[model samples]
Target: MLKSILSFYYQMQVFMFNWIDVEKLVGLFSFEQYDPVVFGTSFFLFYFFAFLFVFRILAKTKDLKVWTIIFFSIFFYYKAAGIYFLLLVFSAIFNFYIGQWIFNSKNENFRRIIFFASIFVNLGVLVYFKYTNFLLEILTDLQVGQFNPLTIFLPIGISFYTFKAMSYVIEIYMEMLEPVKSLRNFSLFIFFFPNVLMGPIDRASEFLPQIEGDFSVSKEDIGRAVFLIIVGLIKKHVIADYIGLNFVDRVFEVPLRFTGTENLLAIYGYSIQIYCDFSGYTDMALGIALLLGFKMRKNFNFPFMANSVMNYWQRWHMSLSLWLLDYLFKPLQMGLRNMRGFGNAFAVLITFTTVGLWHGANWNFVIFGLIHSVFIIFSMLTKPLRTKFYDKVGLANSKVVNFFQIVFTFHLLMFSGVFFRAISFDSALEVFHQVFTFMKPEVFPQFLESNTFIIILIVLGYIGHFTPQKIVDKITSLITRMPVVMQALLIAVVIWIVIQVKSADIQPFIYFQF
Candidate 1:
């Protein structure tokens, strides 16, 4: 018996040593993966826990907290973008100094020059990375030059970070925000990993102050963070991924293969899928930031509830919309003020066209932008007429009328989503073609039978979306009040559900491409 025990112990030691391959362990930290690290993954969760552990250890030291976060954040970006992470570092350094220069300049003319130069450099980088192939393609089609498309890796989150950087410089130039004194703090603002990929587009004025202040996390913050993260996971993995994989993708890929009813339902599915996909990411981003004791502005606000195209824009992607309004639309409107109503209309067109082009280099995105622009311009022009008609019909304050208005606005946006979600302009047209022409009502029963679960998810998704703010707040409060053990159990249960429901491959967030 003693001899057997000794042999077993020796064997176990050998096995343990063999299992621990130092090279493989180190490779895990290297930037050699084909896919970027994203939220809602086992890998991200593991690293995040490790990050929090280190964060808590250094909680009392402000310098350590800031530097540790910056280090982890840089590592996060390196994993996400590989060598391209250097671009983020460059952007932070470039923008910090530009902001300082803008703020320190005493001469108005020199300040304006510096500001424009900064804008040009910032936009120049964005356009080169995002639009180089696009411009080349356009030139190829136009026969201006026979050019092969150049290979360009769009650094993930370039659009988002570029906007953030630009906002910092612009705000400083306008004297709306003072330049941040510390380069490390400004770097943290840019490199803050949670919102770095897809953002609520944190402003320096708002986020820099938090960095300078003391770090503290309340019980309520913890509860809210857990709630948001869980809800976001459900939205992405349970609803968005499941529905998109099972239904919407099939129909959109080849609308001619399905009936009009299927096509119509697919359109509806896409609308919800995108909302859940995007807002889910925002939720997780916010939750993660909150856990770090930073708060980002809200990004989505139950956009489907909006009763007009304008209101829809206000509710959907609130951060980007506000950015456009403040930076693009307002300036354009000011420049075109002398044109009166035409100016407003033109500004709306120009601003939203930029919105479309900002989304992608494709004509489909342009159409998506144009559709909204036309409706917004129409809404602006017809506001008085609509109000008069509503007042005359005695339906201005009717809940029923408002409900229909919401429905109408939802469908209008859904219509534009065809262009937004399709592979190309022709594919978008094909979707409409099939929807209008392929009236196969005979397949309805079979479709309903086959897609029962998807239909149920869709219904539940909308129901959750339409849940009143009061109810959402109450649920949040209840979660906040729960015992620590209960919260842990809740999180464990939700994560289990996510693991069960998620597809074989994790669905990258929709806005990651943007």
Candidate 2:
């Protein structure tokens, strides 16, 4: 009987060991094309919880904490971008050494050479990955060459991290910031996964100092982080995805099939969808960073309420806007200062055009950028006249006037967003054509009845957006004061709602393409 029992146990052990699929287990740590690990996914959540546990254990040892986070970040990137994570490491190393070289060199001529060369190398990689096919298409169109486009895998977040790396080098060259002495810390800045994919484009000057200190997280920070994460979940999975899948995508896909009013509403819907989607991602990123004991700058500020194009740019994607202003526009404007107003105008045109191009490699984006540039120039030129007119009409401080201005500015931006959202220039034009030629106001009742849920969500989104700052602050403060258990319950509820509302297939954030 003892011999029989021992034999049975050995057999069971063999069967149990066989059940473990070693290849599958290894695949979990590697990238899967169909199941790329990203924020808000089940795999990422599991990975994050595991990471948090490890992080807590190592928190007291500063070096261990930093290295642990770095390893986690590397694994995160590898799961997200596969072997391209190596590209990120190479870029980080290259830029780090370049910044140090620029800082240490005293020869002005050599510094300029290194500066331009580094810029070229950085931009060259970006151009090769992002615009090669674009340029090839252009050449084909011109009949200069009929070459086939090459297959190139764009490493996720190349645009964002490249900008961050360039800014680091630029700051050092400009003497505005010092080069990081330790490569490990520099790598952490670039590899920091929180805002890695989409970013407020955190600066080395602002981010590196925090790395020098010990890791810490306060109760208030935890509360705020929870609040922001919950809010982000609602915005993304609830509002943006719901409206987009049901309304905006249908209309934009085939604008001619919808009535003019429906087409117009789709445009408005897209504006809300994109804002909620992009800003939602930003909110989650900020919250995640906070949980890791770091603070990132804010990226948006109720952009829909802007009263002018200038105000809209200031409030919308404020990080990119500020980066452009500080690095591109200001530099160009200074270079052209000899020509005064004409130079300023030229700089604005060029800078905004670059802004549009930066969004994508397409003519529609170019048109979108041009449209903003023209409006911005007009806004600048008419500022004095508008000021005089408001003063003359005694409406400079009129609330009614301000409301109309806000509405008008929003419509202008919404119009530009058509190009931004549409699949092609032709598709964008079709949307406008439908609105202008086939607008059937009589179908409004039917449309409203059919899309009641989407419309209500849109309305609610805008209402939340336009809420006064004080009221929003109060809500955040209330959430922050909640007990830890309450906060956890709140997060759980929000997540449950997200799971219930989310479509069968997860909708990737719109800006991911950019």
Q: Whose lDDT is greatest here?
A: 1
Model 2 has an lDDT value of 0.88
Task: Kindly list the per-residue Cα lDDT of model 2 for residues 353-391, writing each as its tens digit.
Answer: 988988888889899999999999898888899999999
TM-score of 2: 0.96
Candidate 2 — which residues are off by over 4 angstroms? Answer: 1-24
| Candidate 1 structure quality by residue, lDDT tens digits, 300-369 | 9999999999999899989889999999999989999999899999999998998998888778888999
lDDT of each: 0.90, 0.88
The pairs that clash in candidate 1 are: none
Question: Following a full C-alpha superposition, what root-mean-square deviation does model 1 have from the true structure?
Answer: 3.0
Backbone Cα, N, C clashes tallied per candidate: 0, 0
Stretches of model 1 off by over 4 angstroms after superposition = 1-17, 21-23
Work out the TM-score per prediction: 0.96, 0.96
Candidate 1, position 48, lDDT: 91
